[model samples]
Target chain A: MKDDVTIINCQLINKAQALKDVSFEVKKGEIFGLIGPDGAGKTTLFRILTSLISADSGQATVDGLDVATDFRELRKHIGYMPGRFSLYQDLSVEENLQFFATIFNTTVEENYYLIQDIYKQIEPFKRRRAGKLSGGMKQKLALSCALIHKPVVLFLDEPTTGVDPVSRKEFWEMLKKLKTEGVTIVVSTPYMDEAQLCDRIALIQHGKILSVETPEKIIAGFPKKLYQAHSENNYLLLLEVRKNPEVKSAFMSGEYLHIVFNGEADETVPNLKEIGPSIEDCFVYLIEN
Target chain B: MIIKIDNLTKCFGDFTAVDHITFSVGKGEIFGFLGANGAGKTTAMRMFCGLSKPTSGEGRVAGYDIAKQPEMVKKNIGYMSQKFSLYEDLKVWENIRLFAGIYGLDGKQISRKTDITLKRIGLMNEKNTLVKELPLGWKQKLAFSVAIFHEPKIVFLDEPTGGVDPIARRQFWEMIYEAAEKGITVFVTTHYMDEAEYCNRVSIMVDGRIKVLDTPGRLKDRFHAKNMDEVFRQLAR
Candidate 1:
């Protein structure tokens, strides 16, 4: 089986430069995550590679088929779940699955094994209206519909954005299972913590690639000593700590504050007690410096 | 306290949309109501806001019984829907004015509140721009600002940050904090787990019932999980 999925010097422009010289590749059977905030070019890149839109500059090939030239063949081999729940809301759950399968010149029974685990969750509600199923169930139905044709490559754009936590976990587990079965998956999300779930991730910001690496490597490479600090007048302490000489960055991680220090934690704590530091300290540090 | 709900239950054609859920919000609390899509959080909020009637139960918001004084309840609370609720054909200022009028704000109050809201959302320059022309984030901010244009005692926000950027989401929460500080109870619903952690307290609903409610820290500890994501998983299982 062909392994390389390459995008080189990709560029696209509309209201803004949605993507700027973006380049990346996904190896066969690997889950590659495109991690970034909205309008960070994740969806734009997905559109280009899926042949839904053409990039003004740069080229991409998936499984040795040119995205621009082999549109029909590429369409047949890639499954895409858009950010929005774009299935036929008017139809029943069963009808939606049957419709997607038919579009690919296949039948649900033909690929039943591939979608069995996901489909079973919603099978009891097969007669229920697509719009009537709970959010988690809707997510499962979408996944089943996407996989009904058993595409070699899967592209999901923020699929878990509106899904509940349980559904999100279940979806990720399904992706891992599919990867083991040899499907190359490219998923995009703005959730920073989810970056760790991918085999490799590219952190994109403002249409540019900020960093790309394994999740552990990226966090380990974070350049400053981090500490969780809090005190009375939490907001005021955060402001004061940010002004301190030794404090590098501070951000809110739940109720406590994560403060990055330029010096030793022990030394910094004593000095910070005189002033104070809060979670906002890290966010200010990231933005200012 | 600005809002109180007791045994609130809502049903549509034999299906319980919200089942016997009860909660209350203080004057300045940022209360988060969480559930999967179609999990009944929205339905509960609607019943509280008096947009939909409860099948059986009682609710009081801003000193008005939801069933007996829905108009009074509507006059005292604001609502922003998951979908953009502003008229797309109308200009930004026009949308604000329309909502203000709906809440009975007249003349100077409408103009004054509209100006403040426009400036606060950093959309003062786009006051004349049509809602359709604005980006999703801008539209969301505008919808939120419009919802609270009358300075209601309680604001119900349904998935307010649905499709915006992290930066935009951060900014939106900042605005929420500002409102909460001014003693307006903020009732919000979202499926985003990370965002759920920002609330003063969060209630997680599953299968039309509230399964857990507490501060994020306590919920994490109660579920013996590292984060809200795991907490939800444990409870869901």
Candidate 2:
């Protein structure tokens, strides 16, 4: 399939270079993720792709339309849910959805099928003001508004950043369901665990694209023999593991400490068991090296 | 015990935000408070911090009655929320000094501790830099160090590591361990289940009540789950 979204050598500069020679492609109907921590320039790149802000150099296209030149027409074909809630605070939930629909030159009833699954959950509270809703409800309402126009592609920036785990899971399930409707979804998040849910993810950091691949391929590329160790005191173990010359890197992960040895292990720590590297482990290794 | 509460309830008109929850934390223990959205964790935490008056029940924090001695409770505890922990416009040292002064530290102590903290966090050169200019990871570390600067009896951290990079998040956990070692009880809430595993004991709240409280190992075994996330999904479902 031809690419639904494509970028070539994109660059953005503010006080510092926000995005550096970034280039990636999202296949048709695939969920693409920009995975990085805060200040890694994920937001700047998102803005450039959405045509909300112009890049300093390079080119981008969504649905075969140039982002810079064809932005007016392109805007109608893409839905953007910014990191911050952009819905009208004083407006009722129902009113916000209607307003967005009207802006796209469509009615809520015309696109009702697109948002029905999510809207129905918050439908009972449609009369409540947007600001008065709970965090989860507010997110749902924002998403509903973004989807009310039935765009070809969706842009969700950190949609689940501060959401609770249960709510985050539910939101991902909703995205998976949307994938079946042939809507190309591009999302960004600071959570490493969420990277696995995307069809492909671009690991970005320090205004640079570190890697772009499937989550499984990224984990497979982890360039070290990782080990998991448990101790009565993980903090002390972390310090001790770091002190060893054979240890490449060590940090506490969950109930145990994760360690990477420099060479062949020779009774470095008690009960050292080799373990598969997680996405977080890969991210740390990539950033360090 | 450093903290204790019984039948703590906070009701807003007809709705009960926190419904008769009871739990206790020993000195120097790392307590993980977990819950779903709108599950009443923040309401209960507010009662613990003495920021809100409970509608009913009894509680004591750091040897002061929460209902009758809110001032004392405030004095004996430290708080750091992910949403708002430090002043963005203030210089790094200025924020430290401001919080220190608010905690009743004298000028001499503030200056001495300010230098010590900046050096420890390796931000000595960035002392005069505004907090907003620092990276998110650095800001989080600075906020944590400042929260414990007063050496309060208990430190309450609400999602301290949210959105931080993996390396920095682990470094932040190391700081939590060091605080607990100094006999400062750590009361923290986080959405990350792996962080829940780092706690000495974790309590999962459901519908304004603590459904279970135990060590991570034991909780996993009891729930027959592989990890804390699985255990959480099972309980939450």
Tell me the tens digit of each residue's lDDT in model 1 across A1-289: 4665798888887775478888887899999988766566788888898999999888999888899999899998999999889999999999999999999999999999999999998999999999998778988999899899999899999887766667777888999999998999999875555556899887776677766677666655555656776653344556667788876665444455566667675454432322233222322333344
lDDT of 2 by residue, A81-129 (tens): 9999889999999999999999999999998998998899999999999
- Judged by DockQ cut-offs, the docking class of candidate 1 is acceptable
Q: How many angstroms is residue B191 displaced in model 2 relative to the true structure, after the best TM-score fit?
A: 1.1
Chain A in model 1: its TM-score? Answer: 0.90
Report the lDDT tens digits of candidate 1 across residue range B119-180: 87899999999998877778888898888889899999988887565556666776776677
The segments of candidate 1 whose C-alpha lies over 4 angstroms from its true place after superposition are A231-251, A258-289
lDDT score for residue A283 of model 2: 83
Give me the runs in candidate 2 sitting further than 4 Å from their true place: none
List per-prediction Cα lDDT, in the order shown: 0.80, 0.90
What is the number of backbone collisions in each predicted candidate, taken in the order shown? 8, 0
